[model samples]
Target: MHRVRPLPNYLVQRYHGWKATGYADNKAWYRRLASDGQHPRAMVIACCDSRVNVISIFGADQGEFFIHRNIANLVPPFQPDGDHHGTSAAVEYAVQVLKVSNLMVLGHSGCGGIQGCIDMCKGHAPELEDKGSFVGRWMDILRPRFESVRDIADDKEQAREMEKQAVVTSLQNLMTFPWIEEKVNAGELTLHGLWNDIGEGSLENYSPESGAFHPV
Candidate 1:
């Protein structure tokens, strides 16, 4: 509490406005959600990009989705090395405790994190090559996939291609968890990969059968 400070006036004012309008309009629903705890059916693992709005894009109400965001929306492989693993813990809670039926990895266009991975892999970004960089290590999860699109000469499109590959990698990584794999095998859970084009405001769903992404 000692480390905490009052919120900025702009954010405070916005909160008050939301309380007056949005909150007041849905007082009962909000109260119900609080009293009964969230039972979200889906868990959305999305990129920590300002452009990606997980709620607004789905037109989902509060408590509808248990959402987690990370750099490039990546999920590292299951490593129970006893170190703090925030993303894995969230995935465990969502799959084991919350029992979310659907999990989606949402990747977006022009993702800075994905671009950083590309640069680091190509020996372009010296800063990311440093071992002390947490972002550098995180982006390493996507490093192996970079080879798949290395032939693409266009830098922008190559980054976009790797952006979708991030989603593909995450989907594969989720199954590394024993519990998640068990649930998936039993048909209790489903995994999905998605890519978003921010400029076009379009969403594409990955089709494993066709090995392509199609607009929803």
Candidate 2:
């Protein structure tokens, strides 16, 4: 509490601007949204990268998407050990309570988290190996997938592939949840894995049938 301070001047100004323009323009809609609970149809698991704008990419408005962001958009396997599982809890709420029909894992190119995982797997990031390092332990979820791309000679290419692997791994992990599995099997929920190329402004979708990603 001692370290807490008022919002910065620039942020305060920006908030005023948005409140004046965007909020004013949609005042009625915003009021209605506040009164009625959200009913988003999709839940997007995305990276914490600032450049990857999930809402802008899909042209989504407020209340349309339930987004959960993490280091590499990784979803750990289901383990009900009574631990603080933020991602798992989000998934559970989205599936069992929110009942979102579509669950999407969105990965991006040039992700620092993916690079950290690669570095960690190659033993180049010793700091991440420390027991108390949260990023190190979190990146462990993607550590096993690094072996698949380790043979690639091109560093840039390897990183790109690893980024997509993060999405794939998360999709696989989502299935580990029995509720998610049941919904998918009953044709009540659909899972999607997508990769966004920030520089090119292009998107790719992972096809389970083709076992590869294709341009969207």
Q: Roughly what TM-score does model 2 have, to 2 decimal places? A: 0.99
Alpha carbon lDDT of residue 61, candidate 1?
91
Q: Which ranges of candidate 2 are over 4 A from the true structure?
A: none
Q: Against the unseen true structure, what C-alpha lDDT does each candidate score?
A: 0.94, 0.96
Q: Can you write out model 1's per-residue Cα lDDT over 6-83, one digit (the tens) per residue?
A: 999999999999999999999999999999999998999999898899999999999999999999999999999999
Q: Can you give the lDDT of residue 145 in candidate 2?
A: 96
User: lDDT at 44 for candidate 2?
Assistant: 99
Colliding pairs, model 1 = none
Q: By lDDT, who's the top model here?
A: 2
**Position 70, candidate 2: lDDT:** 91
| Range of the 10 consecutive residues with the lowest summed lDDT in candidate 2 | 114-123
lDDT of 2 by residue, 171-206 (tens): 999999999999999999999999999999999999
TM-score for every candidate vs. truth? 0.97, 0.99
